[model samples]
Target: MLSITTFILLGILGLFLYLLVKYPDKSIGTNERPDLVGPRGLPIIGNLIGIYLKGFTNFNYENLTKYGPNATSTSLGFGRLIAINDPECIEYVMKTNFENYIKPNLLKEALNDVLGDEKCGDSNENWRAIYLTQKIFVKLFEEDTKKLLNIMEAKVQSGETFDLQQLFFRFTLDTFLKITFGLDKNSFADPEEPVRFAMAFDSVQATIDGRFLNPFWKFTEIFSEGGRKMRANCKYLSEFAYKIIKKRRNDPKALKNPKDILNIFMNAKLEDGQYLTDKELRDIILNLIIAGRDTTAQTLSWMMYNVMVNPAIEQKMVNEINTLLSNEKPIPKYEDVKQFEFVQATLYETLRLHPSVPGSVKYCLGNDVLPNGTPVNAGELVIMSAWAMGRDERIWGADAKIFDPERFIKDKNGLKPSQYKFVSFNCGPRLCLGQNFATIEFMTLTTSLLRKYQFEIMPGQKSPPDFGNSVTLPMKDPLLVKVYRRN
Candidate 1:
């Protein structure tokens, strides 16, 4: 005989079984997803949850290797990830149909404060601002570059183990400050005290990178520790940027004639004859400083490291520079740099292996098919890996992973990867505006340093490049090396 309690327990068990059959798992199961093959995860939650946790660099390599380098795409619970490594597909996305695939909202949220809206600046005003900014950097590169070399000489005098990456950062940052805002903060000379604003600027970027991992990151905007750091960083950097802008605005000489990029924007007027606002000028100069500084520094650090690892390459590069240097000056003249084939190739090989900007991310605007027949739906994030392509055996031959600069120089058949194939500065209309300026800066610094000194990677340093998570590719660990003055 069943008691009332017994009857109730039986009834509950029956209902639970009924519901299980009534509503089975509704998630898009393994191998049942739409034409996309990638890492597996919980149903409807996306296979990319773990990948995002790892990082974009890891996220790209895993997908490309699994789905074949020709093309790949996946849904990351929140948004879709579409990645392709083939040059034809890359050209299609970056060049042929550039207007459609723009920087998605998520990316903008991460970088808008630092990079600004004019990365692909197409308007007349944007063009003029880029033109004026380029002009200023080129004109000032010589003198400011000399200042940087002087600081490196001081480091040699001390002869203590030092961070090469930090020195590069100070050199580039100092150059940007003096060239754009006409402010000189000798950061390299005094490495004991770090700059507050620069520290904040870096913190903001790391937090922003965190946002990309979570699709529902907005929920934590005010709650999480990362969000708190981001808010503080934004406030601090904005204050610092605005202070510089306002100081330049009130200066009398700024209006009479342009002395820097800030002066150009301050004096600039449209056909109606009114100067750009303080906010507009501030964003522009800030964008230039943010975009231009870290990249050149990263490239220089990587190039120096590669030279250390490959002594033969270093001697070849030094010999080329020795032959090219003008008798009057100790360093190669500015125009003579382009003539150094091996020197240029060394830089190229360095970029190929360790691109400053490793990958490209764009949002698909419509249902499109890649050259490789991978279907990309609207609203999916289209990611392409320059890092993977730089190492792909199919594209670059069996020795693709070798650090050989001759691959870039005149080959046996005069064969070389096109800019579209090997894109460190990006390609098409959205191509890096500072490419020429960056190249000139890179070559000038490399020649100057090589002519005067040799860098030896300190013993006990990590071998496979340890990289940090940032918009720019910075070494994960500070590059510690000893510098010797060349005879």
Candidate 2:
């Protein structure tokens, strides 16, 4: 972080540079809207030093709460940033006027390095069709889900304390690969043994996250060790993808599940009737991995922690699960999982509090006015902070910060979040393709865990909800816990 003195010096230099160049203003050659409120700052890097000082989560909260649940702006040297939390404004940006808000240059720069390793389509019509049509084989994931339960059973029998986040990471990784790529090469069976591909993929996530926070990536990236690590990790990930693609091309078993995601994509034809190139295929799988992996695991970790923190909620959810499985002790199938509304509410509540994707940045493709009466200019970046939105008092009443699943349970429509309110899966054109798969994966694991085991948060851990600066919000510290068999 830049010191206060240094920030002032940079502000002076920034103003000098601002005088040399001309940039468009919102109104009267200045942005001084009462509705669009934020802390006053210099000509460029507006309030950035303050943001850096407070950290991302705190910065978001301060702005959203202090400025009201509307739109606020902070102009950096490169571009202007508008932080928006209002649901109506969020809806406008996410859905109503979706085309106008594309991923900004900052996001592009952060993701550019790994783009070529090319894992996932940028969600064109063709990509969306293939993604939405592909039915994830639930049986495959359920089978792996059992393996995860068995592993947990082992931990309990051995009386061992464990990091819940690491466990979920391995489970989600394997489960995602199994359904998406028709592969079952999970090293979560022995997490301590280390999986090169998994570790490398994780490195890619952290490295990408680092870029988001880096204002000097354009200059510093070339000389930094983090940059080198990012490059190496990208290579490792691409090579790993290529190897799977190669193996699957020759193996008939890859098509064993007719609805297999990879098989469907591999067989899919573009508008020109040409099949997706190897690069495209690799990218698609990579996209699925990113979409499916950390988000669920992190959300699961948060759900567990929140439930542990509030035991009555956990008991109520377990009761709901038990009611659904009253007659038979068999594992809940896809249809059966739907009956666990309370379980869903518990998870949804967690999402509201600690959304896996904490914040999103979208570039304004055209000038437009937000519903809250904030006029935005073309080329400015708009940051939609789900983390902050979930905590907005206007949206959720005074107890917005409270982890109360009952809010969702009573509302009936709460689980199906209204447009911008629950954006964990996002909304509109760019909503997540893997939403169904993720929900089922969580249900299968969560429901089964509740059926057989009782979880307790282990003592002496800080339990600070410090989120890592990744694209997907993960706990910076391990969530240690102990488990016992239910009678």
Best by TM-score: 2
Instruction: Give lDDT tens digits, candidate 1, residues 38-88.
Output: 655543445556666778777777667667564343444335566788888
- Write down the lDDT that model 1 would get: 0.73
lDDT of every model, 2 decimals: 0.73, 0.75
Assess candidate 1 and give its TM-score to the true structure: 0.87
Candidate 2, 270: how far from true, in Å? 1.8
Write candidate 2's Cα lDDT for 264-297 as tens digits.
7776666777877778887777767877888899
Model 2: per-residue Cα lDDT at residue 41: 56
Badly placed stretches (over 4 Å) of model 1 are: 1-34, 70-77, 119-139, 269-275, 326-328, 411-417
Candidate 2 has its poorest 10 consecutive residues by lDDT at: 20-29
